[model samples]
Target: MTSGDVSLETVTAAKAGDRKALEDVLAGLQDRIYSLAMRVLVNPDDAGEATQEILIQILTKLSTFRGESALSTWAYQIAVRHILNARKLRDRDLGLTFEMFATDLETGLVADPPAAPDQALLLNELRISCTMAMLLCLTLELRLAYVLGDVFEMDHAEASRILELTPAAYRKRLSRARAEVIAFTSQHCGLVSNQAKCSCPRRLPAALKSGRIRSGSYPNSAGASVDYAAAKQQIASVVDDLKTFKLQQAVPGQMCPEDIRGRLTRMLSHPL
Candidate 1:
């Protein structure tokens, strides 16, 4: 995704019908594309499907690589468009609002910790799962902005180009999205807000009984973990609103699903 000459060379080689070049280029993009799709759809199955489709489109349209943008930007443009279309066909609404969630916070939700050490291990797993799932409440557009800006650490100007918005417009959207996520998490997530009573342990039992968290495939934060005390201090800082978003972003939830790259690569080998 770095700028300058290497990107152009890769695109040029891939376009010129170097099979290895095409494979290598696609290998690099598969996970990033899948990650974006997962944020949009909040389902690994859907994200995998979308990633394969997007990869095919990018490969087939390589000749149109105009160099006006980085290949990553161009690829993301295709990805954003495809994901938008897919979302229209899928369920795109969360039906819950920050206002609704804010109201829920007043009830003081809490859970009893598991007595056994084995269950304690599972509790950690649930924390990450719930953290990732919380993102599903955001509208697809706002979620996309947050993922692009905060999670992926993309700059506003480039993110604007990817989302096809003016830089100022993109900033406005990202700011609003960041604020909503921060406010909700601060009031509802135990890790983000120490005073908040809602912790993953409280929800783990229900999630397990419902078959949401399976046996071998334990959920994880995917990126680094943030200490609750540190996060709490950051949330209380002067610029806490913005700082909270960055802290949460530091704890990324997941990347692509397992075997996605292999599945797509095999599928690609056969035909269009």
Candidate 2:
């Protein structure tokens, strides 16, 4: 859904008060909005609320579509704006910085953590949550740059447009983000560096103790195993400094709540 996945006919139909056509358009945007929100917000509850707000804006603003940009890009621009300017989530209230996060990572390490039969799944969940948390260490601007340019692999032109920045400015932001993230991971994450102290198994005990990940709270499928060795190999298999972003991107996106669709459907019954 890069430029214009939604057809002009559909956009026109949506703008003209066609309920079915509008749902079609909104459905296409839902997963993407939710995914972006999840990355930016980290907390599921926060991401879900932000997703709904962004979708409502898109729904109310559908008539403003001029077709100058891809519908996806236009909607993404809205999402990026909301994320950058939105109020902070509870998890973010900690004001996590790289230095503080580094210390936190070092605080809990179990040489022989408790073992579970579902060890693979536990590691996968930890990998997802831990990597997602890393993005919080960056400022909103830097995080968006890293997610769009580095994680999602969007072109500089498109990413810059979405971020409302010049290509050069976006590039510089991404470069700084890339360097900062890479330095942190390479120095503290065992997945990207042999010298790092944190490993999924080593941190699992602390994570559970701290309620970072609770029993029965794992997403349907957290993701494939991402032990330090396997994650390191996965990174080595990709281009440089993508280890963190690759892991971040691999976490399954939050599914848009079904009630959102129903709510929007009911809204269509009223005057816009």
Which one is best on lDDT?
A: 2
Candidate 1 lDDT by residue in tens digits, 1-272: 44232366677777887766777778767777877876666556667778878988888887888888787888899998887777543564557666675454334334554543455446555655555556767777787888899888899888999999999999999988888888887777765667766665565555566676654455453343654344445545635466556555545445655576676566556544
Candidate 1: C-alpha RMSD after superposition: 3.5
Off by over 4 Å in 1: 1-6, 87-89, 92-111, 221-239, 252-259, 267-272
Q: After superposition, how far is residue 226 of candidate 1 from its true place, in Å?
A: 6.7
Who wins the TM-score comparison?
2
Q: Please report the TM-score between candidate 1 and the true structure.
A: 0.81
- Model 2, residue 186: distance off in Å is 0.4
> lDDT per residue, candidate 2, 13-44, as tens digits?
88998888888888788888887887777777
TM-score of each: 0.81, 0.90
Name the 10 consecutive residues with the lowest summed lDDT in model 1.
Answer: 104-113
Query: Cα deviation of 136 in candidate 2 (Å)?
Result: 0.3
